[model samples]
Each structure stands twice: as C-alpha cells, then as structure tokens.
Target: MKNTLIESFVFLFERELDKLEAEIKQYPDEASVWKLEGDIKNPGGNLCLHLCGNLQQYIGEQLGHSGYQRNRPLEFSARDVSRAQLLNEIQKTKLVVSATLRKLDDESIRQMYPEEVLGYPMTTVFFLTHLLAHLGYHLGQINYHRRLIGR
Candidate 1:
C-alpha cells in the first residue's frame, strides 16, 4: 500500500511536468513566457521563475543536493527569458527530478530525512507531499498566465 502511494506521487509529478510543458508550448510568443506579473507590494513570483526554482529546490532537497541555491528575491527580480531557453530549462529540470524519483526504492521512501534536509522538521513523506502541492500550485499559476496572454 505504501509503495502504491509512492508510485502515485512519482506518476503525478510526471503528469504535472507534462502539463507545464504543454503550457509553455501554448504561448503565442517568447515574450509571453515571461508575462506573469506580481509587484513588490503584491509579492508573488512570476510563473516561469517560480516553477523552475521551486522544482529545483524540491528535487535538490529530496535528492540530497542544495537545490539551486534558491534566492526568491533574485528569482522575481530577473528579466524575461526566451521561450526556447525557458522550455529547455523546464525540460532539464523535469529530467533531473524524474531521474531522482526513479532511484527511490521503498526503503528510501520510508527513511527519515534530517531536519536540515527539509530546512524544517518533516518526514520524508511529508516533504514529498509539500513538493507535490507546491508544484501543482505553480502549474496553476502558469496556466493562469497563459490565459492572460490568450493562449
């Protein structure tokens, strides 16, 4: 039963990745890729950077890596990136995450992560849930941005 749950998460992550890829491809132009908006006062990260950074952080933290040295302020401060470049980044990140998930045995999933690994106290299962939820939220943001651009 536990193994079934883990497999579900892995499968769900792949589905979300595919959804994000489709979202990017649906955009009318490269500039549309960076069209997500939020101001300093509003305090929301743009879809492109948010998705990439969040995925990087989650995958890195899970796989026992630093997860892209996340600086949220810098992520929001950056300029628009090209569509091709953004798509390539998305693909690369998804591959890394997928590969990491592929390596997990049942024993690995049941293992407890150090507090430092999570940057807070959380069981491995909880940490995985957090990533899944976070990614789903950002995917929604991306889709919202896509609608704003009429794509």
Candidate 2:
C-alpha cells in the first residue's frame, strides 16, 4: 500500500515535470531564451537550466550516479540552444528522475542525510519535496517570462 502511494506521487510529479519541459521547448530560442523582462526575476533558459541542474544533481546522487557539473555559469552560458536540444536534455533528465523515484521505496525516503549536505537539518524526504517545489516555482517563473517575451 505504501509503495503504491509513493509511486503514485512520483508518477504525478514526473508528469508535471514533463508538462513543464514541453512548455519550455515551445519557447523561441532566438528571442525567448535570453530575454529577461524588466520585471521578471530570471530569464527563461536560466530557470530551465536551474531546474535541469538541480534535477540532474539530486536524482543522480540519489541513484548512486555522478551528477551534473555544478557550474552555475553553464546554466546561462548557452543563450541560443535550439528547441530540439533543449527538449532532448529535458528527456534525458526526466528518465533519470523517474528512475530515481521508482527506486525510492518508503524506507529509502525515510533515510536520513548528514546535516552537512543541506547546511541544515532535513531528512531525505524533506529534501526531495523541497526540490520538487523549487522546480515548480521556477517553472512558473519561466512560464510567466515566456508570456512576457514571447509573441
């Protein structure tokens, strides 16, 4: 029963992640990728990269794999990524995330992490939820920025 619930949550999360990635891939790279509107907090590609980086990092470590390079510069460095490239990256990340979540049974989720990892006290579950929320918030920002800069 518990396993089913966790899997369901993970499936739903992955579904939402897929939706956001699809929306982002629709962005016109020439204009929308680097456009930081006057009021927007972050550009579209940066937000996408942030989500991508964090997802890659967390899912990789949790699955006993090496993570993406924690290079903040690369997130924003490529301002002209083609839509196909962006979507391809997103697809790769989605597979990683889905696999990680699938393996995280209730016991694994209940596992504790060293406080040093987070700079504060938090269980693995807490961190997982935090990352999900972080991704969603940034995705919203990207969507808003898209509307503002997109025609």
Candidate 3:
C-alpha cells in the first residue's frame, strides 16, 4: 500500500508541476503573469513562487534534507519574475518533491511530520496530502488568473 501510495504521489506531483509550467508558459506575456485582476491579491507569478518555496521548504528541506532555505516573503512580494526563471524554479521544485517522496518507506510515510505545519501534529502522509491540495488550489487560481488577465 505504501509503495503504491508513494508512487501515486510522485506521479501526481510530476503531473501537476507540468500543468503549472504549462499555465505559466501559456500566459499572454511576461507582464500578464504578474498582472493583478480586480479583487485578486496574488498574481500567477507569485503563486508559482509560493508553491515552489512551499514544497522546497517542507519537503526538500525538512523531509529530504536538501537544505533549502525559503524566502517566504519574497515569494509574494517579488514581482515580474521572468517565465524562464519561473519554469526553472518549477522544474527544480519538481525534482526535489519527487526525490524526497521516493525516499519514503512505509514506516516513514506514517510517521509524524518533522514539523507541526498545521498548528498540530500530523502524519507525513496526511501533510503531504494537504500539500498536494494546496498546490492544486493555487494551480487553479493561476489557471483562472491566466485566462482572466490581459483582458
């Protein structure tokens, strides 16, 4: 079960990251990636940065011990990041997430996460599930932002 579960996670992460890359690349222009629509605070570029930082921080640094240092503020504050750079970051994040998850064994997946991310203790698998959901949420937002921007 654990092996299958881990494989599923790896596949999902790879697939979603690919989707994210597509979303950013599909933006009309570099400016469109950072354009803010009415009532919306975060743009597509920042969302991509946030997702990269998030997975790198939690999975890469904490689980995989890749020693990643996250600049949480920069993820949202910085703007106009080139699509090329964003795509590179996305690919890097994909590698980190995939490698980290692949290393997990059955016992490791059920163990408590290295940090109390949600203001409470949770199993590694649960936290990973949450991370996947979070990624999807922002990916959806980016998809919408891409379509709605440049209007």
Q: Sort all candidates by TM-score, best to worst.
A: 3, 2, 1
**Residue-by-residue lDDT tens digits, candidate 3, 5-113:** 8898899989999999999999998999998879989999999999999999999999999989999999999998899999999999999999998998767899999
Instruction: Supply candidate 2's per-residue lDDT for 71.
Output: 67
Tens digit of lDDT per residue, candidate 1, span 3-74?
A: 575577668877887888788888777776665455322112256566777767766554647456777676
- lDDT (Cα, 0-100) at 104 in candidate 2: 69
Best lDDT among the predictions, by candidate number: 3
Q: Output the lDDT of residue 116, model 1.
A: 52
> Using alpha carbons, what is the TM-score of model 3?
0.96
Q: Pairs clashing in candidate 1?
A: none
Alpha-carbon RMSD to native, per candidate: 3.6, 2.5, 1.5
Q: lDDT values of the candidates?
A: 0.68, 0.71, 0.93
Model 2, residue 60: C-alpha shift (Å): 1.6
lDDT of 1 at 86: 68
> Which consecutive 10 residues in model 1 have the weakest lDDT in total?
36-45
Pairs of colliding residues, candidate 3: none
**How far off is residue 27 in model 1, in Å?**
1.4
Q: For each candidate, what TM-score against the reference?
A: 0.78, 0.84, 0.96
